[model samples]
Target: MVKSPVPVFLFITAEAVALLANSAFLVVFPWLVLSHTGDAGKTSLMTALVTIPTAVATLLGGRVIDRIGRKPSSVLAGLGCAVAAAGFGVVSGLGALNIGTLIALGMLAQAFLPPSTTARDALMDAIASVGGISLERLAGIRQVVFSLTYAIGPALAGLLLTAISPIAAFWIIAGAWTFAALLTTGLPSGTSRKVSEAAITPSGSVWKLLRSRRAVWMAVVIGFGASVITQPITSVLLPAHFRDLHQPQLYGVSVSAFGVGAILGALLYAAVGAKAGVKLYVGGVLVTTAGIVAFALLPSFWILALGLALGGLGSGLLAPMLLVAVTRNTADNERGQALGVYNAASLGASPIGLGLLSLLLQRHPDLHAGAFAVLGVWALAAVYALTRPSVIVSTPGQQQAADTAAV
Candidate 1:
């Protein structure tokens, strides 16, 4: 067994740093666009530009992970993001930054995100298998780490934006990505020897493989649903709402609250090691939708925070459970591709939702709450439709046994 702690530690550390950088960039980028253009529509368009390329990259990310090995792929992705961020910062510092420039840089930076994430997931799986760690536990730990970064990153960005220039903030992000890239060098290389040759070979089109497995399709659908509801709210709506309220500080608080709740939810799942059943997953989605609705409709600041927390917790719970489901349901060699499709679906939904929300708000800027209400209901309906007994079906006995033991 590969018993060294070096790979796991380095992987987690690098991921945490990268996530922090990305989260901060997310906060800073939109704020910059909105502040500069004074237009939410432009900000939303910028977000879409970033997301679309990331989705495309994610669709091909699995094959890259499988072919090049996780370590090298992760390193290269991290380096790519760093370079893009640094370039953006330099351009901004030179006073050449515009919406088009921002969009181009955003696309460049985000294009690397999906592949880095894909490689990290694949690396985690390899670590779990070789180190005899349970995938569920590892996933739980990952969620918690992510939550912590999410908690810290936005708050830090808000502070930085308040005290520093946008160019400086971008430079900080560039540095963080550089740090993360450096950390990746310590990770072990090569594919898992335990993976079967049959599992590695392409059996036909990836779409066909996905269609053959109910769980895979279910994961993709649910991921897409979750993304549609959550991404637009955080990315476009909440920012616009807070800006209108003239309390941009509250944006950071709301984001931190969500992250805190996510941490709690992930920790709970980690402690309990619950089965990733359809019922549990759907329940989380329902709870998330309700929380988002509350966030949209509630008048009080405290209430909005509560809603954000609840929604975030629900999202947190759903993520790991879905990951566990997909991981368990897939062949070891096909795992990267399956997860790639899942990631791609989830990321792809973000641009569509953001675009729709942008158009809606552009047309009816006062209908923010109403729009969120509609999205919440839509998400609920999608989850209900997707999680029907006919859709999810039961897990195989052997897989169920393995899941139980892992938990």
Candidate 2:
């Protein structure tokens, strides 16, 4: 039997909407904290407080996805996100939003986000299998969509925050997730065909196979590093920078610039990624690291934008590069587990970094000093990626990434 294209497209659309909503919500939430309290330390602390649940969820949510089917998991995740977001919006609308309530509601809303993301990835894999679609091609397309969300999502949130109240802006997040849940219900539903074997639970042989693949192992670290550094940029520092300026819209524009740069980087990966060898990935990381560093050094408007754009470009390349590296190295049976570890490393690392940066920035009175420190850390991470080994020799297309980079 032939599968219809509708489900695949519908799945993509649902993910796009859901992601856009989540991105907008994240931007709005931090700003809300900063604006209301007029304190950068509290904002950083609150952001870290909210991030804790998401990191924890990413670590442990695989079993839930396994038990309940990715499709149902996605649907439930959307609903949970919507309900949590709505609760926050309701409280804010009532003029009762406070730091304690914000953290509680933010944590509630954030906890669902990782599961929602994981379910979507698993769902897309299942969809590709059923539809005879290319997972690589689909993943590339989704990466573009993801980048677009950051672009429009923050800008839109900024607009709403400017024109309407944050309460109204936040309500839109709830509505978008609700819409995403409804859209997910239309897609095909089934449990993951692959088993759930997390690193901790993996047998000795599986663990050995994973570690033996040094390139992919290091690739996960690179991704984890990328995420860890980027979080402070998005969550703590940038917001503080804008809070000082007293301009919410520029904050959105700055983040949207990162998103736009990410779009280009993702597109670059799509164009030349199949053959993107170790050298090209390292080059991109170094170049993007400079951009982030520039962002920290120069706080002026246009220069700041340029720095973030460069940082954004690096994000685009690093994320997909990690995905391709993992998919190329692992077998079908091992892919699920490897991906779980990758997600944990990539997404889970952020909370720790965010929390640490929050502490550093909170203690330091000057945001610029703290910001430079964060960028310096990211620069070190980029240097670390340069030192790592390439993918396994047996893996296909290792030369292609290199060849393309050379071109």
Candidate 3:
């Protein structure tokens, strides 16, 4: 152990804020756009607003994280988000908020957000290596933080919708992240050493990993499929569903159950996922699909919430395992770049999903039908994934040996 819990705690808090910002995308941000413009097109466009730039930025930003150092990247990320949030507040107050401004600011925030968060991921991995924390424990803690934020962030954003103006909530987002930046007020008090060129670049390290490591490749593929399934639902369908019902709060609250279920799932993973095999992984994906089916087939409030929670449980099981797979497959010096690549491909699918969903929402009167169609797409993608050989996960010593194996 590195002799301090402060860095780990600080890192977790910063990550929580980032996840909260994402949950905001799935909640208040959509409401802000729709409430202002009353346009589903604009609201659906919000998904692209967040994802496209994030996908592109993360792809490029992964190498940037290695080049610039982790702490600086993180600080920059927090500041970017702060500006975006504060900008929203300022524009709304000035009566100047418009789609153009929203798009520009959203791009700026997302462009910075993922790389910085990835940097933090690298930073924490380093801390764990040096801090006496096992990678499994570290991954578990991070997954828990993610799950908790997903659980609470939407609920909080929704509550804000009910209790506060979107503008005020914007300021609160700004203030929270500003505090995040101050923390340089820092993780492990800063471990942003520059990675050597060889470490940073290996003809796109993540792609190489995908080619060589079945586990990493499978994680990215499953992650991409999951991303494709989720974006439209979280960013478009559910929000639209609840707002139309004039029960917008349910959107956030129901999503919260997904997060809650994630916590349970993550805990279970911590308990046993490390040793679990392909069958368990397949089960998780199926469970996740079942949750989406609930949306396609059921519209009752409590049922939606329960189904989402069930989905969360499934997701929770897979998430930490994904992290472990990626980390186990990469060395410390190359972790950020590799993760960036993993994230880029995985998250890149999100914009595609959103774009297609946007078109569907525009053409279709029934959102549930749109959801059913999404489920069909997911089924095909899952088939593609399930057909691939299950990843041959191994113990750390064996994994490290495999990591350095020739492609």
Candidate with maximal lDDT: 1
What are the lDDT figures for the candidates, one per model?
A: 0.75, 0.74, 0.74
Clashing pairs in 1: none
lDDT (Cα, tens digit) per residue for candidate 1, span 1-407: 55766666777788899999989988988887888899999887777667668877887878766666677878889889888888877887789988888888889888898988887877776776655666767778888998888878888899999998777788889899889988987765543323444556473467776766666677777777777767777766677778878999998788778878888878866665445455655666677776777777745678888988888888787777778767767766677788898988887776677667777777777755545655665666565645553334345455545444644
At residue 341, candidate 1 shows an lDDT of: 89
Over 4 Å off in model 2, which ranges? 1-4, 27-48, 88-104, 129-133, 161-171, 189-216, 234-257, 275-283, 289-307, 328-337, 354-376, 387-389, 392-407
Query: Candidate 3: how large is its RMSD?
Result: 4.3
- Is 2 or 3 the stronger prediction by TM-score? 3
TM-score of 3: 0.78
lDDT of 2 by residue, 143-196 (tens): 888888866777788888888777777788899999999998987654244344
* Clash list (residue pairs), candidate 3: 1-131, 1-132, 2-131, 183-186
* Residue range 1-407, candidate 3, lDDT tens digits: 33676666776777777778767655766777788889999788775566567777887777788777888887887788888889998887799898887777777777777876787766766666656666666677778888777667777888888998887888888887778777744665446667777666665546665677666676777778777877787778888889889998888788778778888888877666656666667777788778878877757998888888888888887777677777776666666777787778667777788878878878886887788988888777567666743543455566556556744
Q: What does candidate 1 score on TM?
A: 0.78
